[model samples]
Target chain A: MRPVVPYVTAALLFGLGVYGVLRRRNAVLVLMAVELMLNAVNLILVTADTTARAVLPHSGQVFALFVIVLAAAEIGVGLAIVLQLYRLRSTVAVDDVALTEPPVSAQPVGRDVEAGR
Target chain B: MTGADLLLLALGAVAVGAGVLVVSTKHLVRAGLYLVVCLGALAGDYLVLGAELVAWVQVLIYVGAVVVLLLFAVMLTRAPIGASDDLDRPGWPAALIGGGAGLGLSVLLVDAYRWSTVTMPGAGTAERLGEQIFRSWVLPFEVLSVLLLSALVGAVVLSRPDIGQPAPQRGDTAGDTSTPQTVGADGVRR
Candidate 1:
């Protein structure tokens, strides 16, 4: 039971994150899932850090700190982009705003056209 | 199980539950709020793991800054605050893919390191962490800072309002008291 608690928590968090990314349609939720995944990784790092405090040094915690900062910046910019999409589409559902190809227009010409063209 | 183990189980349950709610709930704002809960639980887990500095930073950066920014964006975008019944896409494939990947990774990880505790040094403190970040990781840290600065500049450039006319504030009782309308697709009020 030494590291069991942290291990279970990390696994659960990772699983939930997967579920979020899979099932959530809102782009915001997707971003949140990504954050959850990152935090799960952090938990593992901290657990390992605790176990190896005497040998491997503080690199684990330091790496986790860097990750936190990176996650902040990523969320800030990501939400801004999502906000932009919402303003244009009036909805945040990820599938609603996809544009595969631009519409094109051209003159129509056909052999079965009316009269002589 | 010890007290620490019980605490870990509790935090894990909360985090997983909140994460499920975050995705399954129809209200987007609630989802963002749930993320706060999930991250908080994660911070608690970090504390239990003895990474106190990392734990606090998790609270500060994720719960304090990231989620707040997300909420602000949700508010500014005027995303529906209530349950939305819109079914966007066929999500089963993505779910299957993600779930499969997670399962595979979990199995691999468990198989590779099953309850094998290998404790290294400086796991709980920040002294060596500071040294590492300043020494070996200095270049990457500086690069990350520059990247953040550029992102900030880009956000301003892309989303700044370009409204042609100025309007009275909502608090001005002499005029219409309606809140300012967000202007464009880019979060600019124009």
Candidate 2:
């Protein structure tokens, strides 16, 4: 099998993920996009490992396994955060969660005035 | 191209196409399903590359556990099962960027390794992989386990904030809206 084929495929997959992350407003979907990107990287790693001329052939597979594990942990924490955000705001839209400022009326007037200085 | 080459090309096509669907599909459930397809095809690609252990692990972890977790989260979050109008912004900019990146990377790769072919190594068996994991890769594996444990605990804590807090009482206070309490038939907060 030609290595360039898989390489091109991984590149396209990563691009799709970047698009999803940048354009999708839903936080859960964004997480899914990130998963896509990680999977692309895994493909590249396994491909390189398969084609490597080294004595030990399992390094690429091992690295791919680590990436998979990390992706699992990432999705777990990400989903938990999304669930909590939904509970607090009743929406999973990324635009709704404003990290820069508190929700209107939720912040005390005195605290807002203190920050104004 | 040989039969193996053809199979690899087919699998790669399926993987990339499903990956695109994963990010572009409007239905959340369908998106998860596409992710499964994408991951499954990638596993097939690994099998074609003679990495049996990694292929199965890909199937077991990504398709079985991770996508299931995502689906559960989707249901738990009450995401719209159908096409969600509020889930996306303008598509033109994202499409442009994604296409540009894909084209650029493909061009770079082809330019760097135009006709180079690397011979396939021997298949990575389960025993060899296990030895490597327990010996040279031991530290990173153990650290990953710890990370998984912490992620489990953290997810539980984040999802259930009222785990250690005292249950609300009828006369406690009317101003506490932070906690979501359920009232039982006996008029006590559960």
Best by lDDT: 2
Alpha carbon lDDT at B19, candidate 2: 83
Per residue, candidate 1 scores C-alpha lDDT tens digits across B106-175 of 6766766676654334345567567778888899899889988987876765453332212442124223
Interface RMSD of each: 6.3, 3.9
Per-residue C-alpha lDDT of model 2 across residues A48-114, encoded as one tens digit per residue? 8866655665899899989999998999899999987886667888977777766554333333332
Range of the 10 consecutive residues with the lowest summed lDDT in candidate 1 chain B: B181-190
What DockQ does every candidate get?
A: 0.27, 0.43
lDDT of each: 0.69, 0.82
lDDT of 1 at B11: 85
Worst lDDT run of 10 residues, candidate 2 chain A, spans A108-117
What DockQ does predicted model 2 obtain? 0.43
The per-residue C-alpha lDDT of model 1 at residue B37 equals 89
TM value for model 1: 0.77
Q: Give one digit per residue, the lDDT tens place, for model 2 in B22-48.
A: 877889999999999999999999898
Measured against the true structure, the TM-scores of the candidates, in listed sequence, are 0.77, 0.85
- Over 4 Å off in model 2, which ranges? A101-117, B163-190
